[model samples]
Target: DPIFLSSFWQELFTLQGVLLHKSTAYHPQTDGQTEVLNRTLETSLRCFCSDSPHTWATQLPLAEWWYNTTYHSTLKCAPFEVLYGQKPPIHLPYLAGESSNDMVDRSLEAREAVIALLKLHLTRAQQSMRDKANKHRSDRQFMEGDWVYLKL
Candidate 1:
């Protein structure tokens, strides 16, 4: 993790005009969204590297791509699309619909239908994930100076 704070990364970010804001340590739920995303990514890495733990560093790019291109219910679009104003050119295997034609038709109607179906599937998947995550969660409120345990 120290590599992220190294001079090489700092120089690259500076050359690209990117700003890096460090997060505070020992803070309690200052940014719940970030906390949730970090937990999700950690679980993903655990599963992905469970077999070959040493290969995780090499697999990070693939994880990042999957996250960026996946539908975010809150955003209503993939993160990549929001940043680029267009969908990322990721070629997933064509769904085996009714049948396949030797010659593909490059028509607007076909593209529109495909986009619509994709949107529907992504929405459903998002709902499913939300449902599963909320199943074990409860509405809990804590006040200042409440005795609570931190997971660290």
Candidate 2:
């Protein structure tokens, strides 16, 4: 676990513009997003490798791909779209009458539409999350040196 606090990991996150926050021990809720993603990943792995549990590792990439491309309730858009500004294309079997040029054109058009939709979804999702969080938040304030019990 100490390895996670090493300079290498810290530098890696810094380069990616990620801030690593250490959560309280035994408090998974403190990192709610990670907990939810982990649960989703587990469910995806189960669905993908139910018949061959030993092959779960091999199916991990596919599961991750599916998870990223799937729409999330909180985000209101696929994670892939939010990050890349477009939905990832699924490989479908070519139709007998479809030309490569047509496929390419359709793909580009679809990407544009996905990016537009993702923008709207992101705005709505942010507002929804803000409202939900505010609903349960307390107005209590604590100043420096104020006595507070730390949960162990």
Candidate 3:
């Protein structure tokens, strides 16, 4: 059943522009950030479903919202804000008195600020990741016919 499901998913994702990479069993690094995101989502689900695990499905949207609103160490900004250029406002009865036009203007200004910050954060994160990765890597050259053991 799982094999069939996996095959179905592979087909579905490929059709949706997702790339599938074959990897050795138990190798999380092969998928890079996808593995990290899965761990984070699992942790969030566990926290949300402590009392009723069956309710996890109902809590998924809330988990997604929390994840999107939470700041990432590398990104230095909430995922939603980075993508949309502004953070979604929390419910505030007091702010209901403000005119819609004023709110729009304020949101636009905040979005511009956030976009600037996001660009800076992205650059810094990229450089840091490159430096860290290079530290663990070695420079090597291989001839066309050279045999190298590929780690599965």
Best by lDDT: 2
Instruction: Name the candidate, 1 or 2, with the larger lDDT value.
Output: 2
Candidate 1, 32-141: lDDT as tens digits = 77888777666555555655668667555655776788899999999999999999896544443533553353333344344455456568779999999999989889
Q: Looking at model 3, report the run of 10 residues with the lowest lDDT sum.
A: 91-100
Ranked candidates (lDDT, high to low): 2, 3, 1
Per-residue alpha-carbon lDDT of model 2 for 7-64, expressed as tens digits?
9999998999999888877777899877987887887666555556787786677668
Q: What TM-score does candidate 3 reach?
A: 0.42
Runs off by more than 4 Å, candidate 3:
1-29, 91-152
Local distance difference test values of all predictions, in order: 0.69, 0.73, 0.71
Q: How would you encode candidate 3's per-residue C-alpha lDDT over 1-152 as one tens digit per residue? A: 35634878879987999876676667778888779887888877776565567877766776677789888888889999899999866733233225568776665554344334545656877999999999989999999999998988
Q: What's the TM-score of every candidate structure?
A: 0.42, 0.44, 0.42
- Models, CA RMSD each: 13.6, 15.0, 14.9
Best by TM-score: 2
